[model samples]
Structures are given as structure tokens and as C-alpha cells.
Target: MLKLGWFSTGRDQAARDLLKVVWQRIKEGFISAQISYVFLSREPGESKESDLFLKLCQELGLKIYTLSAKNFEPGLRQNNREAWRAAYHQKVYEMIKHEPVDLIVLAGYMWVVSAELCQKLPMINLHPALPGGPQGTWQEVIWQLLQEEANETGVMMHLVTPELDQGPAVTFCRFPIKGGEFDPLWQNFKEKMRQIGLEKIKEQEGEKEPLFALIRKEGVKRELPLIVYTIKAFAEKEISLINHKLFDNKGNLLLEPYDLTERIEKHLKTGEW
Candidate 1:
């Protein structure tokens, strides 16, 4: 069995959803590997997503481990910057040391991992934009594209590096945002904004404590499938990194080098790129 370790902050619905999809895929025979353990940056008390993820892991018979940044700090600061990072990574590395983790997948991990950690294992991350798409958080990536009037955008699974979202590509799938037919996209964006705005209003009104639970719920619904597909490709040896280039099993580039917005739009209209 290919042993795997999952890393996520458990702050977003996508993170939870991604794991669920992977779990489902494994159950359905789309993936043939064992999720040896899950490592989380935050403890369950901090976020309901973390709580639920732990519960799911328990139900699935996977081991669970956590390293709280809050707890690690100060002690983490006792060492030099490099040493601190190493110490923190050691927490994660120790859990998988006894297990046979072939790959580490970052779903919604917020921190930029230390170079020491990357060098220690084969890891990959899924970004909410195309490779070299934008250098910001997922929300920022979308907002920046909107500001630039980009007509298309995509998601990519890539090798994780210290630099955010600068990883070598694994696979990318894109969709078009027709300039005139922007209603669907706009509606989606507006709905998200409205939901956030309402949540803020509620928090200010003191109806309930601030919660990130909704985001995690959405992740499980929308982002799970993509994560599963990416992992399936990896487990089946459908992905390869060669000379800093990522290739599919047949040696074709998984992500085309050029921006494919126009091509994608054309494909949407004519059914071919």
C-alpha cells in the first residue's frame, strides 16, 4: 500500500471536502492507497473543521496527529529561525517516521512549509489558480483576476515549494468566464460575498461566535473531487517531475505553458481547444 500523509489547516470547506473526496475515491476503487495519518496545524478546539476532520479520521480508522502553532511558539522562538522551523517540522516528521508515507499532500495548509520539510518528503499542493496565475491567497487570486478583467481562470495541482504557489505543475483544468455571460460567475461571487457579509453582521450583533465552519462545509462539496483526481494521478504514477517540468505518464506536459483562457473560451463555444 502507498502510505500517505494529509496536511491541512482545517480552516476551509475545501480542505475537508478534499479529504472526503479522496476517501470516497478510495472506497470506490479510484485510488488504491492508504491514508496513513492526517496532520493538522491547529487543534480541534480551534475550528469545527478540525474537529470534524478528526472525527472522520477516527471513523475511517486513520490515525490523527496535530501540532499547534500557538503551542509551539515562544518555544519555537527559543531557537534560531532555521532551527525553529526545523523543530516545528520535526513534530510532523516524527508522526510519519514510523509509518511509510510515500507522499504528503497539502490541501489547505496556510503556512509556507520550511525547505527542510520539503526536502524530507515528496509533497504536492493544490492552488486555486493556474500555475503562475497569481501570487496571493486564493481569495486574492480571484479578486486580482477580476480586477484584470481576465476571461478565464483555472485550478492547478503542483509540487509545493517554499515560495507560495510557485510549484511545478501536475495537472490543470480551466473554465471560461464569458465576458458577456458573467451572470453565473458574478452570482457565485456575490453569494459568497453576501454570506460573508451576513456572517460579519451576525458576529457584530453577537448572535453567535465567529465560526469558520461554513467555509469547510463548502470545501467538502466543491473542492473534494479535484483533490481526489490529483491524488489518483499521483498514486498511479501518472505524474512525473523532470528537469523542473511536470509531465503526465505519456511524457506530455500536464499544464500547457501558455495561458489558455482564450483557448478555453473557444472550446466552450466550439467544443474543442
Candidate 2:
């Protein structure tokens, strides 16, 4: 069975929901794996949100570990950030080294992992955009996509390298942001951009813009299924990473994102986009 090492800052309800969903899938025999440990970056009393996340882990009976990163080496964190980041992750490494994790999943983990630690372990993260697409937080990605008039955007799980969100994709699911319900919205966006430009529209209505909201809604619906099915592939040995490159069970090199669009959409909750 694939042994999972879960890493998350537990900063939001998404963290709690992701853990719940994965654990539910594991219980339903959809994934042939066990989560060996859930390593959090904050402990109790740090923040009400993270405390709730910690509580959820305990409630689910998963092995919970924490290393409070809130104010570690305050002066050093402010002065020499790289040094602090490395030292911080070194301790994080020490905390979970003995658990015998087969893979690490960055599920909403909010820290930039040090290169040293990236080399020491195999990790994968969920990126909101497709491979070779926009880079940055989900909001930035969406804004850039809107600005680019991108018709298609997708979700991907990629190997975690030192560079944030730049690693090669392992699995992905793509969906169109145009056609259907989006046509009128895109028309409006184009008209508005011509009137006041992208920045001005953003200032007026940021994420709430219809096109942006619709894009995010569709993307968010796919995110959980993508993560679950990716784990399922690892558990079934249908996919594996060899020398940091993705390959199938037959030793076939996967040069592109292993397209899971059909599979993910099949499992997605019924809705029209």
C-alpha cells in the first residue's frame, strides 16, 4: 500500500475538507493507501482556524504531528529568511523522518519548502492551472488567464521541486472556460475591459467578476477529485515516479499530463457548467 505523508498549514476550511474527503475515500476502499502522518505547521492555540484543523485530525484518529512555524527564530526569520526557511524545514524533516512515508502530498501547505528538503523527499502539489499555464496563487492564475483570454484552464498535480508550481505534471484534468454559460460573461468581460481596462475592472470587482467566479467554480469542483484520483493511481501502481519522472506501470514514459479528465468528470458531482 502507498503510505502517504500529508503536509498542510491547516489555515482554512479547505484543509479540513480535503483531509475529510481523502480519509473518506480511503475508508470506502477507493484508495489502497494509508496516511502515515499528518504533519501540520501550526499547533494548538496558534490560530483558531488551525486549532480547528488539528481538532479534525484528532477526531479522525490520524497520526497528527506539528511544528509551530508561526514565530520560529523571529529575528532570523526577518533578517535571513533563506537560513530560517532551511533551518525550519530541517526540523520539520526531523519531526517526520521516522514515519516511513512513501509519498508526500502538499494539500494546502502554505510554505515554500527548501531545496534541501525537496531533494530528500518525493512530494506532489495541486496546481490550479494546467501545465505551462499561469503561475502563482489561484487568484493570480485566474486573473492572468482572464487577461490572456484563455479558453481552457485545468487542474494538475505535479512533482514538487524547489521552484514553486514549476514542476512537471503527473496527472491533470482540463475543462473549457468558454462556450455554454461562459460566452455571455466573456462578452461582458471584453466589453468592460475595453471600457476601463483589466486593472480598473479588477479594482471595481475582483474575484466576484462573473467570468472569474465561473472559472473558479468549475475549477474548484474538479480539484478534490483530481487529488483523490491521483492518490488512487499511486496506490494501484497505475502511475509511479521514477527518477522524478512520471511513468506508467508498463514502464511507458508519460511525456504529458496523464489525462484524467474523463475519469474526474465521471466522478464529479452532477452539475452544468
**TM-score of each candidate structure, all chains considered together:** 0.73, 0.94
Query: On a 0 to 1 TM-score scale, where does candidate 2 land against the true structure?
Result: 0.94
How much lDDT does candidate 2 score? 0.89
TM-score of 1: 0.73
Clashing pairs for predicted structure model 2, backbone only: none
Instruction: Report how far off residue 205 is in candidate 1 (Å).
Output: 17
lDDT of 2 by residue, 115-175 (tens): 8888788899988999889989899999999989998999999999888789889999999
What pairs collide in candidate 1?
12-216, 13-215, 13-216, 13-219, 14-219, 17-220
- Candidate 2 ranges with C-alpha deviation above 4 Å: 269-273
